[model samples]
Structure formats: structure tokens, C-alpha cells
Target: MKLYTLKTEIDAVPVADDFIAIEAPRPDCPDGGIVARVIYLSLDPYVGSRLRGRHMGEAPPKPMEGAIPGAIVGQVVKSRAAGVSEGDFVHAMEGGWQEFAAIPAGHFRKLDPKSAPLRAHIGVLGMPGLTAWAGITQLAKVMAGDVVLIDAAAGAVGGTAGQIARIKGASKAVGIAGGPEKCRLVTETYGFDACIDYKAEGWQAALKEALPEGASVFFENVSAEMAMTALSVSQTYVRGVLCGLADAYQSSGPAPHALNAGAIIGKRAQLRGLVVYDFYSRWDEYAAEAAAWIRDGKLAFAEDHADGLDQAPALFAKLMRGANVGKPIITVSEEQA
Candidate 1:
């Protein structure tokens, strides 16, 4: 099977042609496993951290080694596992970059494609959704009437968090996206009360204007500049939930703002960084609740799907450039006879 793995820590350039190939003997014990035909691969921001050995150590450089990072959902084409079988659509730790992935029986969750959008299992209902949920409910404990603001509001985490807050009974929801286009989306599609365009000059001022009373909760997705701006405008006792550093992901450096440490201390505000994996232990519980909300039409979500793993390299490049609208999932295969 062809696989992509990061082979170097080239911060400026990602060398894809350097991908090396190797053979794996067919597994001797296929009984407890499922050979999945990778359907959709999630090109998440967190994977960028794994490209380098220092930030996250998923694959160390060997120039001719792995060129693909894995985090995919697939359909079981062949399975010796009892509960799962051929034609079963599922989500797994294995990524869809490869044509085939043999996953342990226990790692796969059967996807009800009939009930929810098949692609959502890897997008909104997948890791990103979990990030939004855990970031809001678990960490910040967003409550009814809480003035909440989500940075990158039209993107994966922020968009969903803004909506979830309302479903959970927050009085107001504020969002921040790149421009007026997305700002409209935050208010219309995601049910946010207000949204700001960070790309617009004086965007921070817009944020302050939107929530003049000051945000009680900040669902932080992009940190540094946006974060400090939010902090400067935050109300006392606000809860800031940190998720990613997308604004500076492609750039190498310290956070832009040199805001005094007192901002947080004086406000007695809660700023906590979050990772989706930290709450994986509650996956089943979370998935069940989230799924029910979708069924009830309470939680709204969107997916940006790309066709083919071959499209992944370029697609991911788009993601890194912040061109994608929602969770970007590359569809590797469709139903076949």
C-alpha cells in the first residue's frame, strides 16, 4: 500500500516527491482486523506540528521516509472481525492517504451513513467537532447567558463552538472569521449573534464593538494577536479556551502580542490550552450526544470535501494557507462493484 509520511523538518518547503515506498507482507492474522479502503482523510492543523521532530514527534526525518500524515476515515472492504464487515463505513485512527489500511477491530467505529453525512464522520462529527465540544463544555463550561466569542468562527472549531453554545443555552454567541463573507456565515449559518472580520483593519475594534459588554467566555482557536486582542477586551472572570496557533502556523516566531501578564492575572480569567486527544477517552459519550443533536437538528455542521488522496497534497497546502471553509476531508474512494 502507498503511504505518505513527513520525511523532513523543512519549515519553508514540504518535499512531497521525496516520498519512499516499502512493502509489507500480508498479515498472518486477519481475523481480528479490517482492511479498510481509505475513504476520507482529515488534513488537520495539528498534523503540522508532527511534521517536525521537535514540535511533535510522529515521524522523524529520513528524507526518503514517510511523506504522509495519517488521520482518516474509511469503509471496510474486507473484515474478519465479527462485529464489522465488508461495506461497513467506519472511522479509524488510520488515515486515508494510503489506498488501504488494516486497522485493529477495536479502533473502528461503524458510521451510520444513512443518518448523517458520510463525510461528517471525519469533519464536524469527527475530531474537529470533538475539539469544539470538549473545548467549550469540558474546559470553559459555557453556560446559558454566557457571552461567548469563538475566534476563526467560520472555520472548523470556531463555527461549531458558536453554534453549540446556543444549543446549550448561551445568551449570545460571537464569532471571528476572515472577512464579511464569513462573518455573515457565523451569524446566519452558525447562529452567532455577531462575527468580526480579522482581515479587516481595526478588526479588534470590531470585536469590541460587537460585544460591547465584553465576552464572558472566549473559545480561542487562533492565538497570539487575536488572543491578546480578545484579552484586552475581555471581561473579568472570562474563560479563554486556547486551541491552535493558525495565524502564525506558517510563520516561525513568538506570539505577536507582548501584553502584560496582568491581563490574565488581574481579570482572574481562565486561559487553558486544549487538544482533541486529551478528551478521546470520552469519545463514545461525546459522539453519542453530538450525533443526537444532529439528529434533532440542534447542532449544525458543514464539510469541505476533496476527491482523491492524490488531491491531498495540494488540498493540504490550501488548508495551511487557510483557504478551506470548514473541516477539509479528502475523499479517497466511492462505492464500487
Candidate 2:
């Protein structure tokens, strides 16, 4: 087996070779466990913070030890678990950055390749999609005629949330993204009503202009500055979902911009913090619904792919810097046998 391990403690955005490849014996299939051959590895922004011990309650991995953490879509090559059989395709968080993984029972979900693309199992039809579904449908309860806003609108969560808002009958879906290309993706590709490019001069003003009626629901994925900006133009009693703090993930200290309690209090906003793990129990429910949406062309998603296991570190580095256009994925092996 082959895997990548941490080469050093990550201080900021990891550069080249922060993860090193090494050879290891294949892990044995333990009692009530299955050994799977990894196919697609999911790379996410949160991994950067987790690697530095900055994420919520997750300890950093020792240098050159432990498999780097990630989610994977794979095929079971061996099984010791009941109800799970050899050759089953599954998705699990324990797969890590390795060619093969031993996943314990109850820690993995079976995937139907016919339901959607295998890669989609780790992207739009996977955890990112589940996150968006939980925040919009479960937390915010987006309703008809509501005006919704989202930041980081090109990536998986933000992109899917905006689309889900529209699907649920929101009158308008507005997005705030970094560049013209991503802004185009938000509006044209994801079907948002308008997209404001924050990198452009006067974008904050543009966001205000785009939302004349003010936002009724705000799905926040960037920084506190952006959150304040969105809140400034929000409707009274807006439902705000705090999904991710992409800007502050690399920092060793607290978030750079503090929350403005006054602004939130004045609006009487219903602010909810979204941690996706809390929604894991609903994965099957969400996947079934989202797969239908994808089959019907109602839900759209994007992915940025790297070719091999060795490319994981570079792709991860790109993700931490917010350079990835969509869900970042690594092709560890062929999806089909």
C-alpha cells in the first residue's frame, strides 16, 4: 500500500511537499471491518486547519506519522463485517490519503454508482451537498419569495446552497464570489439571480445594488467582514447560517474579524452555526433526494481534480489558498474495476 503522511507542522498555507509519499503493508481487514481500495479522495478547506490542530477538537497528526485525514470513495476488496460484502462500493471518512483503507463497521456508507457518478459521491451528492441541505432546508427553512445570499459561491457548499434556495421557491438567489469566473459560475452555472465579484472595485456596493429587497436568508462561508457586509443589507429578522470561515482557517489565532453583536441584535437575526457532523444521520435521506435532483438536472455541481495520490498535497495547498474552483478531488485509483 502507498500513502502520504505529514512532513512537518503546517503553520499557514501548505506549499509543495508538505505531505510525503511512502510505502506500507496493506492493512488487514479487522473483525467487523472491511478493507477498501480507494478510488476518489475528497480534499476540503477544513483539512488545512485540522492539519495544524486549529479545527474544532481535532488533534494534529505527528510529522511523518498517521495517514493524513480525508474522505474517500472506494470498493471493498475484503470484508469481515456482516451485511457488507466484498466488491461493495462505499464512502468513508476514515479512508485517509492512502491507496487502501480498513474501515470499521458502521463507519461507512454504501454507494450506488448507477445513482450518479462515483466522483459525485464525494462532492455534490456527498457531505458538501449534505451540509448545504442541512443548513438551507433544516436550519434556515428557506421559504417561497425569500431573497437569499451566499458567499464562496463557486465552491461545493455555497454553490449547492444557492441552488437549493432557488429550488425551494426563493424569489431570488444572490452570491458574493472572489473573481469574474467564479461569479459567472455562481450566476450562470448555478442559476443564482446575480453574483457580485468581491475582488472587483466597489463590489460591496454592487452587492447592495443586486439585492434591492434585502436578503431574507444569508448562507455565510467566508469571513466576518463579509458577514457584516451581508448583514448590513439583510432584511429584518433574517435567517443567517454560519457555515464556514474560510478566511480564518489558516490562522493560528482567533478569527481576524470579531462578530458584531450589535448588528445581529439590531436585525433580530436568527443565526445558526452549522457543523455537518451533526447531520450525518441524514446522509441517506439527503443523498436520495439530491441524486434525484441531479438526475433531473435541477441540482448542479463542479469539481477540480488531481490525477494521483502524489498530487494530493499540491491540490490541498491550492484548496487552503481558496484557489480551487469547486470540490477538490484526487483520483487515487480508477473508480471502475
Candidate 3:
């Protein structure tokens, strides 16, 4: 088997020193386990924190050792568990950037390739979709007349959150993205009521224009200026779902923002930090709803693809810098279907 592992300690944007590839022994399907051929690997900003040994709970990937962990979509080639079979399509959160992975059955979910594209299971139908659903539907509790604001609106979780807000009957769904193209996609393709181009001059004014009445729910992904901007225009009883701090992911030093504490205090706003893994048990519920949204053309998503496993390291660097328009995905192999 081929595996990509951390090559050395990294600071700033990850470079070649941050990753290396080597041959590894093929894994086995242990009791209650399934060995699958990796087909798609998802690159996310939080992975950078994990690489830097900042993630809690699990031991961080050791420099120049251990397989780099990630969410993956794959086809089962062997199974030692009940109700699982060879050639089954599956997805796992703790899988690595390896050609094949042997995961406990409890850690993997079977995917229906007939229902949607295999890779979609790891994109819109996977963790990103679930994150969007949890933050918008539960934490924010978006209502029909609510106005919603989403940061990083062109990215996977943000884009889906915007669309889901609209689907749940929000009066206005506004997005904040970095470029004209992403802004266009957020509004035109993803069906947000408006998208503010944060990279453009006077973006604050643009945000003001888009949310004339102020936003009631904030699906925050990028913190710092974007977060402060949203907090500034928040309405009474506003709910903010704190998901990712993409802006601070690669910063070498402190990335601080002057949040208007008065605004939150005066509005009685609620800001809740979310870690999607905590809500994994509800995956089936979100997957069902998201699948219907995609099937009905009510939701849309995009992927920025890197062709091979060797591209994982550079892909992470590019994604951290916001180079990708949507979810960053590495194609591990052709789907075995």
C-alpha cells in the first residue's frame, strides 16, 4: 500500500517538508473491520491544526511517521463485519491518505453509489453537508422570516448552509466570499439572496447593502474581520454558529479582531462553537435531507480537485490560503463500481 505521512514539523503554509510518501504493508480486515480502497480524500482547513499538533483528544500525527488522517470515500475490498460485503461503497472519517485503509465497521458508513456520485458522499453528502445542516437547522434554528449571513460562503459547508437556510424558509440568505467569481457563484448558482465580495474595496458597504435589515443567524466559517463584520450587523437574539477559523489556520502569529462585545451583549446574541464529529450520530438524518435537496436542485456544491495522493500536501496549502472555490478533494483512485 502507498501512504502519505507527515515529513517534518511545519509552520506557515505547509511545504514539501510537511509531507512524504512511502510504501507500507497492506492492511487487513480485522474483526468487525472493513478494508477499503480509497477513492476520494477531502482536504480541509482544520487538518492543518491537526498537522501542527493542536487538535485535542487524538494523538497528532508524528512528524515523518504515521499515516496522515482524513475523511475518505472508498470501496470495500474485504469485510469482517456483519451486514458489510466486498465491493461495497463506504465512507470513513478517521481514514488516512493511503491507497487502502482497514477501518472498524463502526467508523465507516456504507454509501449508495446509485443514489449519488461516490465522491458526493464525501462532499455535499458527507461531513460538510452534515456540518451545514447541524449549524443552520439546530444551533441557529433559522426561521422563515430570518435573515442569514454565512462567511466563506463559496466554500463547501458555507455554501450548503446558505442554501439550506433558504430551503428552511429564511427571508434572506447573504454570503461573504473573497472574490468576484466566488461571490457570483454564491448568489447566482448557490441561490443566496446576495453575496458580498470581501476582497473588493468597501466590502463592508456591500455587506450593509445586502443585509439592509441585519442578519438574525450567522453561519461563521472565517473568523477575524469577516466575523466582526457579521457581529456588527447582527440583529436582536442573533445566533452565530462558529465552525471554522480558516483565517487563523496558517497564521504564524496572533490573528486578532476587535469584536463588538456590546453588539452581542445588547442583542443578546448566541455564539456556539461547533465540532461536526460530535454530531456524527445524526449523519443519516442530515444525509437524507441533503440528498433530497440535491436531487430536487434546491442545493448545490462544488469541488476543487487535485489528481493524485502526491498532491495532498500542496492541496492543503492552497486550500488554507482560500485558493479553492469549494471543497478541496484529492482523487485517490477510480471508483471501483
Candidate 4:
């Protein structure tokens, strides 16, 4: 077996040699565990913060010893648990940066390959997709005629949120992304009504111009400054779902943008913080509906994939820097055994 371990404490964006690949003994399947050959590794922006012990109370991986944590899709090769059999395709959060993982029985979910592509189980039809669905439908309650706003619109969560809003009857879906290419993807590919390039001068004004009716719902995935800007132009009683802070993940200290309490009060906004874990119980419900949407051409997703486990570190670095165009994933092995 081969795996990548942390070389040292990551200070900012990981560079070359941050992760060292080495051989290890294949993990034994425990009494209530299953050993599966990893197929796809989902590399999210939060991994960078988690490596530095900056994420939601997660401990940093020990240097040279701890395996990097991530969500993975794999086919079970050995099962010691009841209700699971060999060759069962599953998705689990504990799958590390390794060729094979020993996953506990209760820690994994059986994935229906026929529902969508196996890779989609970790992207659009997976946790990121669930996050977008929970924020838009469950929390924000996006309704017909509502104008929706999303930042990091090229990302899995934001892109899916905007599209879901449209599916749920929102009149217009607008996105704020980093550059022109991402903006183009948001509007042209994801089918958003408009996309504003946050990297360009006067983008805030551009966002306001694009949403003439004012945003009725805002699915926020960037920083507090961007959130405040969105709230400033939002309609009265707007629904706001605060999701990710991509800009603050690699920061050395507290985020520079201070939250403006007045913005929430002035707009009488209904604000909610979204933690995808809270909606885990509803995965099946969301996945079923989202998969149907995909088949019907009502939903879309983009993936930025790397070919092997060795490319994980570089691909992850690209994600933390907001350079990835879509969900960052690593193809560890073939999907089929």
C-alpha cells in the first residue's frame, strides 16, 4: 500500500514536498470494518484549514505519521461487517490519502452507481451537493420569483446552489466568482442568469446592476466582506445562508472583514449558518431528487480532476488558492475492480 503523509505543519498554501509518499502495510479489515480500494478522493478547500488545525475543531495531522483525511469513493474488496459485501461501492469520510482504506461499518454509505456516475457521488450528488440543497431549500427556503445570489459560483456548492434555486422557481440566479472564466462557466454552463467577476474593478456595482430587483436570497460561500456587500443590496427580509469562507481558510489570523451587524438588522434578513453534517440524515432524500434533476438536465456540475494520488498535494494547493474551476478531485484508481 502507498499513502501520502504530512511532512510538516502547513503555514499557508502547501508547496512541493509538503506531502511525502511512502509504502505501508495494507490495513486489515476489522470486525466491523471493510477494506476498500480507493477510487476517487475529494479534495476540498477546508482540507487546508484542517491541516493547520484552523477548521471546526479538527486536529491537525501529525507530521510524517498521520494520514491526510478526506472523503473518498471506493469499491469494497473485503468486508467484516454485516449488510456489506465484497465489491460494494461505498462513500466514506475517513478514507485518507491512501490506496486502500479500512472503513468502519457505520462510517460508510452505500452508493448506487446507477443513480449517477461514481465520481458524482463525491461531487454534485454527494456532500457538496447536499450542502447546496440544504442551504437553498431547507434553510433559505428559496421560492418562486426570488432573485438568488451566490459567491464562489464556480465551486461545487455555490454552482449547485444557484442552479437549485432556479429549479425551485427562483426568477433569476446571479453569481459572483473570482475571474472572467469562472464567471463565464457560472452563467453559460451552470445556467445562472448572470455572473459578476469579483476580481474586476467595480464588481460590486456590477453585481447590483445585474440584480435590478435586489437579491431575495443569498447563498454566501466567500468572506464576510463579500457577505456584507451582498446584504447591503439585498431585498427586505432576504434569506441568507452563510456557508464557506474560502478566503479565510489559509489566512494566518482572524479574517480581515468584520461582520456588519447593521446590515442584517436593516434588511430584516433571516440568516442561518450551514453545516453540511447537520443534514446527513437526509442524504438519500437529497441524492434521489438531485439525481433525477441531473437526468432531466435540470442540474449540472464541473470537476477538476487529477489522475493519481501523488497529485493530491498539488491539486489541493490549487484549490486553496481558488485556482480550481470546479470540485477538485483525485482519481486514485479505476472505478471498477
Candidate 5:
């Protein structure tokens, strides 16, 4: 077995120095447990935050120096668990950046290969999808005829949030992304009502023009600049969900962005921050709805995939810098591809 374990605790984009790929003992399947051959590893921005050991009232980072901790999609090669068998595909938050993992049965969710691609289990139908769903359906509570605005609109969570807002009957679904290509994918490919390219000049004015009635709901990602922009254009009684703080994730000091209390007071807006893991109990419900939308062609997703486990470091760095267009995933095994 092989695992990409964290070897350094530095404040920087995780390079090869930060992670070491080494041979390790394969985990044994205990009673009520399954030993899985990991197939897909999710590359995300939050992984950087984990390496930096930033605790915002959340659990501490993995204590072991050579351990993996992130979402993964894998296949069971050995199973002592009831209702699970050899060759069963599964998803788990504990899969880590490893070739094999021994997981308790309760910690694994069986994935249907027939529903979608194996990589998608760690992507749109995985944690990122659930994150978006929780922000919109649970926190922001977007409603029909409402104007919804989302930042990082081309990324995994943002892309899904925009599409779900439209499907749920929001009057307008606006997306903000870095480049024109991603902007086009958000609107033209994912069916967002409009997507603003933040890299372009005068994008703020473009956002204002796109949402003439003001934003009723804001599914925020990225930094405080984008969050405050959403707040500035908010309608009376608007709702905002603070999802990610990408701007501050790599900084050595403090988070560079701050919330504008004046805007919240003036708009009489409701803003709530959420950690998706808190909604883990409702994953089955979200998966059911998301699968239906995907099956019916009402929802769409894209993947920016790297070929192997060794590619995880560079791939994760690409994702942090917003170089990848969609969900950044690593294909850890050839069988899963």
C-alpha cells in the first residue's frame, strides 16, 4: 500500500516537500469493517488549510505525521461488514491520500457505479455537491422569484449551487469566476442565468447590470471582496451563506477579508456560515435529489482530473490557485478509470 502523507507543517502551497509517497502496511478488515483499494482522491482548497493547522473551532488536523485525511472514492477488496461485499464501490471521508484504507462499515457510503462515474463520487455527488446543497437548501433558503448570486461560480461547490438555484426556481442565477472560459462554462454549460468574469475589467458594473433587481440570496465562496460585493448588491431581506474563505487560506497572519456590518444592517439581511460536515446526517436525502437531477439532465458537472496518486501535490496546488476549471480529482487507480 502507498499513501501521500503530510511530512511538513509549513505555510505554503503544498509541494513535494509537504507530502511523501511511501509504502505502508495494508490495513486489515476487522469485524464490521471493509478494506478498500482507493480509486479517486478529491483535491480541494481546504486541504491547504489542514496543512497550515488552522482551527476555527473545528477538529484539529490529523495528528500523525504520515497519515491521510480527505474524501476518497474506493472499491472494497475485502469485507467483513454486513450489507457490503467484495468489489463494492464506496465513498468515505476517511479515505485519505492512500492506495488502501481500512474503514468501519458505518463510515462508508456505498456508491452506485451505474448512477455516474466513479470519480464523481468524490465530486459533484460527493462532499462538494453536499456543500452546495446545504448552503442553498438549508442555510440560505433561496426561494422562487429570488435573484441568487454565487462567487467562484465555476468551481465544484459554486457550479452546483448556481444550477440548483435555477432548478429550484430562483428568478436569476448569477455566477462569478476568474476567466472567460470558466464564465462561459458556468452559464452556457451548467445553465446558470449569467456568469461574470471577474478577470475582465468593469466586472462589478457587469454584475450590477446582470442583477437589476438585486441579489435575494448569495451563495458566497472565495474572499471578502466577493462577499462584500454580494452584500453591496443585496436586496431587502436578503439571505447570505458564508461558505469559503479562499482569500485567507494561505495567508500567514489573519484572514484578509471582513464582513460589512453596515450592509447587513441596511439590507436587514441574514448571513449564516456553515460547515458541510454538520449536515452529514442528511447526505442520503441530498444524494437522492442530486442523483435525480443528474439523471434527468437538469444538473451538470465537469472534472479537472489528474492521472495518478503521485500527481496529487501539483494537482492540489493547481486547485488552490484556481487553475483548474471544475472539480479537481486524482485518479488513484487504473481500474476505477
Candidate 6:
């Protein structure tokens, strides 16, 4: 099977092989073992961190663990289980970067694309959307009238997070993006109460004014600068969700500490690290709800399709550079519009 098997991380370079020969799944393996035909792929920043081996404390990925780093929607070519059958559209944890993948039944879930866009299985309707849901419901514990802040407002996770906050009850939802374009998208498109450009001068003050009442829930996507800024303007009993670190994902710089230790101590606020992996059990339920939200027009999602699997790596770089306004997705399908 062809896969991007990551051996190491080099700057501006991706370690991948188009056709790394490997054996197929065992003949005696479960009948549900199926041939996965790649469809849409999600290019995320976390994959870059995984390649750098930055998340060391977590369980490291073994060779048999799966593909290098990605999520994709695929069509089942062969299936043995009644739960899944040939022609079934499914999404997988490791996903098929190659043309085909022999995936076990358990790691894949059938999805109905007629209900939503097929590519959404890799974007808003997929893990990114679920990540936004679980992070807020499970981590933030959002309440009505609560002031919330989101970093990377135009991203797959943050964009959905901002929309979810507004729908749920947040009286004030502030989104922080890289520049004015995304800033406009945050407020005009995703419906945030305010949008701040982190690159702007006096951005900290802008954020403080945006959240005049102080942020109760800070959905942190960029850790270095934005994380610190959110903490500085956080409410006394604030909740900071450490969802992503776009700022410190690459370098080995000393991570910025959250605003003030005294505030967390004195105000009794909590800061929680959120790795969407931990909430696997709730994914199906989360996806169902999030998809419903989208169908109902409560949650709006935008995407940045970079086109083709070959362009996936470059799109990842673009995402890190904040060039994409939404989830950067690449498709294996030859049809490009």
C-alpha cells in the first residue's frame, strides 16, 4: 500500500513515499476488513507537530499504528460485515493517503454524503467539527451570557467553535485571526461578536475592548501569543481550552505561560489541554449533533481545498502560515473545479 510513512521532520520538507510497498491485511483478519478508496483529506497543523515528535508524552505512533498523519473519507471497495458494505462511504482514523487502504472495520465509520458534502467528512462535518463541539461542551462548559474568545477563528476547529458559542449562549464571542480578511470572515461569516487581527498594533488592547466583560471561555488554538493574550484578558474564573499551538508547533522555544498564575490560583480558573484524540468514544454522537447543526443552518463552515493529494503537504505549510481561511483539504479525485 502507498502511504506517506513519516520517518522524520525536516523544515519545509515532507517525508512521504508515493508507493511504499507493504503487505495487505491478514487473510484471517475479520471479514469487515475492507479496501478503502481515498477521497478527501484533511491537512492540519497537528500533523506537523506529530512529525516533529513534539507530543512526546503522549503514546507514540508505531509503524502499524497507521499512515503518517492525516484524516480522509473513503469508499469501501470490499466489505465483509453487514454494518459496512461495498460502496459505503466511510471515514477513518489513519485514512487512506494512497489510492486504496485495507482498513479494519472498527477504525472506520459509514457516512451519508447525500446529507452533506462528501468532502465535509474531512472538514467541518468530520473530526474538526467534532473537535469544536467536544472541546466546548466537554472542556469549556459554556454558559449563557458568558464571554468567549477563539483563536484561529477561520480554522476548521475555531471557526466551528465560534459559531457553536454563539448558538449555545455566549453573549460575547471574540475571534482572533491573522489579518483583516479572516477578521472579516469571523464576524461577517462565522458570526462572532468581534474579530481581532493578532497582527494589528495594540492587538492586546483590542482584544480587551472586544471582551469588555472579560473572556469566560478561551478556546486557544494559537498558544504563543494569542494564548497569552487571552489569559491576560480572561475572566477571574476563566476556562482556557488548549486546543492547538499554531504559534509554538514548530520551534522549541519555551512555551508561553498562561496570563498570571495568581489569577488561576486566586480566581480559581482552570486551564485544560485538549487533544481531540481523548474524546473518541463521543465522536459519533458529537458528529451527529454537529451535522444537524450544519443542516439546520446554525453552524457555517468554509473550506480551503488545495486540490490533489500531491498538493496536501504544501497546503499544510500554507495552513501553518495562516494562508488558508478554513480547513485546508485536499482531494484525491481527478475532477477539480
Q: What is the overall TM-score of model 3 with all chains considered together?
A: 0.95
> Where's the lowest-lDDT run of ten residues in candidate 3?
8-17
lDDT of 3 by residue, 1-337 (tens): 7898877766555654578898889897879999999999988777776777655555667766678889999988999989988988889998888999989869999887777777887778889889999899888888799999999899889999999899998999999999988998898889998888888999898788888898999988887566667888878788889888777765656667446677778888898888898889999778877887888888888888989898888887788677778788999998854
Clashes of 1: 6
The TM-score, computed over Cα atoms with residue i paired to residue i, of candidate 4 is 0.97
In terms of lDDT, model 6 sits at: 0.73
The parts of candidate 1 lying over 4 Å away from their true place are 5-9, 13-31, 54-56, 60-63, 80-82, 254-260, 335-337
Query: What C-alpha lDDT do the candidate models reach, one value each?
Result: 0.73, 0.89, 0.84, 0.89, 0.83, 0.73
Instruction: List pairs with backbone clashes in candidate 2.
Output: none
Estimate the lDDT of model 1.
Answer: 0.73
TM-score of each: 0.88, 0.97, 0.95, 0.97, 0.94, 0.86
Between candidates 1 and 5, the one scoring higher on lDDT is 5
For all the candidates, what are their Cα RMSDs to the real structure?
2.9, 1.2, 1.6, 1.2, 2.0, 3.7
List model 1 lDDT by residue over 1-337, tens digit each. 5655444446642333434444433333256878877777888776554554434445543444443656677778788888886888878854435777777757677777776767777767788888899988999898888888888888878888887888777889988888787777778878888888888998777778888888889887776667777877778988988887775554445547344577789988888888777887787677778788888888777666778767777767777777777677787877442
Winner on TM-score (2 vs 6): 2
Residue 111's lDDT in candidate 3: 81
After superposing candidate 5, which stretches have Cα over 4 Å from the reference? 55-65
Clashing pairs in 1: 4-67, 4-68, 5-66, 5-67, 5-68, 145-171
Q: Which digits, one per residue and each the tens of the lDDT, describe model 6 over residues 91-174? A: 887764455666766777788766777787787877788788877888898878888899988888898898888788888889
- lDDT of the structure predicted as candidate 5: 0.83
Candidate 6 contains a number of clashing pairs equal to: 0
The C-alpha stretches of model 6 lying farther than 4 A from their native spots are: 1-31, 56-67, 252-260, 334-337
Ranked by lDDT, the better of candidates 1 and 2 is: 2
Model 2 segments more than 4 A misplaced: 251-254
Candidate 2 C-alpha lDDT tens digits along 156-227: 999999999889989999998889888888888899999999899998889899998999999998888888
Clashing pairs in 3: none
lDDT of 4 by residue, 1-337 (tens): 8988888888765654688987888999988889999999998877877888888999988887767989999999999989888999999988989999999868888889898889998899888899999999999999999999999999999999999999999999999998988998899889998999988999888888998889999988888888898998799999899998888885657777567888789889988999999998888889899999999999999999999999998888788778889899999999875
